[model samples]
Target chain A: MIRTAVIVFPGSNCDRDMKVAMEAVTGSPVAMVWHGDAEVPACDVMVLPGGFSYGDYLRCGAMAAKSPIMRDVIAKAKAGTPLLGVCNGFQVLLETGLLPGALMRNASLKFICRDVHMTCDNNETFFTNCYRKGEVVTIPIAHHDGNYFASDDDVARLEGDGRVVFRYSDAVGNATPEANPNGSVANIAGISDATGRIVGMMPHPERLFEKALGGTDGRRVFESALFSVTEATT
Target chain B: MKAHIKITLKPGVLDPQGKAIEHALGSLGFNGVDEVRQGKFIEVELAEMDEASARAAVEQMCEKLLANTVIENYAYELVA
Candidate 1:
């Protein structure tokens, strides 16, 4: 069985959704790790669910990035534990420097909450293996700070290394610059580190997992993590 | 001695609160405002100490608590 843990901070509204997604895929209940806890339980995969941590004070994910558990999260990520961050969790990952760049507020200066299309950019990442390159999926995005930005050089580097895992796309699955919701440099919706162990994305794949809930695109994320550890041993 | 710390979103990081403020200013008859950005200000009182220690403490505060370095920047100066 693939062991997993979901790290929950105060105000995390999507922890349960992520837990359900993981449970549906792994056939097990994931341990819920708290922000104040100094340790994380042993697990093959770790997920940081989304919400307005610390009331989005100082900045989105700013305070949560410094929470005690994050130190362990960072250490675990460095040790090659598969970690996934979504929405506010993505903000936390960036703030902790686990992933590069930052997720800023939308360009329109309004809280964007609705479904958006995304294109698969990386087929090799642990969080992307289930999707073929260029595959399009519709996932919901509900965030104020969803704009992804990095230095010009950083953008170039990410594109060069194929670190960008997903990009915003039109309803037809075409990645058009006009479909960008937050003025992200390259319409990027998700990215992974050079090692591919850590992944962060702005869209809420967890929210779209069940067919009854509207879609099953989220199954891909959990499936990729399963492939993560299994592929290593095989 | 007292120190004031200002933490701001780094350049190019979107500032929604700042944008709202800018919008409010425009509605209130202020014009020609190119942009608006929001930041945080914190006041800290410290015992008489060397400048080096004060700077170090402030930096520690940023790294551990005050600012999220990946998204925001912070600067502090002692007063009195």
Candidate 2:
């Protein structure tokens, strides 16, 4: 069985939703680990869900990054365990130094809540195995600090290494600057680390895992990631 | 002695609360408002004997909690 754990912080609002998505797609129970807990439950995948953790005080994910459970998450990521973070969770990953760059406030200085289009820039990554290269997918994003920013050199490094897993795209899969909601660098909406085991994005894929909830494409991400895990274990 | 650390977002970054204040000021007939930005001022006290220790302690505070190096920046002043 592919063990999964959804991390829950004090102010996390999407832990259950992420657990549900993992269960529905993986057909297995996902352990809900508390932030105060020092150890993460034994799981092959660790998910950091979205919410206003610590009321986003002192910066969105600053306080949560120092949580006890994050130490385990960081250790796991270093050991090549698959780690995924979404929305404020993404901010946590960056704050933990698991990923690069910071998620700044939206340029418009408003909370953006809408469906955004994304294109797969690299399909070979463990998290994106189910999506085709250049394929377009729409996921919902709701955040005040979703604007992704990195130094110009960092952007070049991500692009040169093909670490940018997804970019904001139009309906036709063409990257459109106008369609970008948060003014992220290079229209990037999602990215993986050098090893591809750590993936973080500002969009809430768990919220769109079901067609009834306005999406089904998001499920492919979990499915693909599970496939990678199952293949690795066998 | 106590120290006050003021943390502020960078210039290019957006500050909604600050913008709101600027708007309110403009509405109240305050003119020549070119820009407005918001920041946090945190007061911390230390009983160390030396200035070097005080500086080191404040730097530690900035890295460990007071400021998030990722997005926000911070500056400190000593009040004796």
Candidate 3:
């Protein structure tokens, strides 16, 4: 069984959702880790769920990134544990310097909450192995600061390194300007680190992991992580 | 001692909030505004008596938490 841990911030609304998804996919009990806790339990995967941490004070994820739990989380991630960050969680990853780039306010200057189509840009990564490159999937994004930004050099390096895991795209898989819901640079919806073990994305896979919730498109993400861990263990 | 800090988005970064404010100003009959950019101002009360130490601490704070250097630039002045 794949052991999973979900880091719960003070304002995290999606922690339960992530726990439910992991349990459903991995058939294992998921650990709920408080942000104030100093140590993280041993687990195959760690997730930072979506929410307005620290009430979005100072900046999104800025305060939360400095929480006590993050010190260990950052260390574990650097030590090569699989880490996934979604929505505000992504912001935390950026603030922690685990992921390159910053999530600026939406170019439209509005909180966008809706389903968006994204094409899987890299299927070789542990987080994306369940997806086929160029496959378009529907996922919901709800945030005000989901516009990903990096310096020109950093953006170029990310593209060159095949770290861009998902790009906002149309139903037919064309990454057009109109298809970009948050005006993210290069229509990016998700990216991975150099190791491909850490991923930060603006969409909520936990929100749509089950068919009863709406669609099963998001299940593959969890399944992908489970598969990667299982393969490593076996 | 007090430290006054200003954080602004680096040039070339899209500032939709600032742009919206500019547009609102134009609609309100304010004309000839070339552009508008937005930033944040923060004041910190420091207990450090030494100016050099205070400056270093504030710089560290800005680099670590007060500002995200990825897309923002920070400037500060110390008032003793």
> Residue by residue across A15-134, what tens digits does model 2's lDDT show?
889999989999988999999999987788999999989999888899999988898889988998899998888999988888888887787788999898999889888788999999
Question: TM-score for each prediction?
Answer: 0.93, 0.93, 0.99
Summarize candidate 1's per-residue lDDT along B7-72 as a digit string, tens digits.
Answer: 998886767779889999999989998679888899989888888888888789877778766668
RMSD of 3: 0.8
What DockQ score does model 2 reach against the true complex? 0.48
Per-candidate Cα lDDT values, in order, are 0.88, 0.87, 0.93
The residue-level lDDT of candidate 1 at A24 comes to 89
Q: Positional deviation of B41 in candidate 3, in angstroms?
A: 0.8
Q: By TM-score, highest first, what's the ranking?
A: 3, 2, 1
Q: Is candidate 1 or candidate 2 better by DockQ?
A: 1
DockQ for each of the predicted structures, in order?
A: 0.55, 0.48, 0.96
lDDT for each residue of candidate 1 in A89-112, tens digit (9 for 90 to 100): 999999888888878778887799
Whole-model lDDT, candidate 3?
0.93
What is candidate 2's CA lDDT for residue B57?
91
Q: Which segments of candidate 3 are over 4 A away from where they belong?
A: none
Please provide, for model 3 over A48-94, each residue's C-alpha lDDT reduced to its tens digit, 9 standing for 90 to 100. Answer: 99999999998999999999999999999999889999999999999
- What's the candidate order when arranged by decreasing DockQ? 3, 1, 2
Sorted by lDDT (best first), the order is: 3, 1, 2
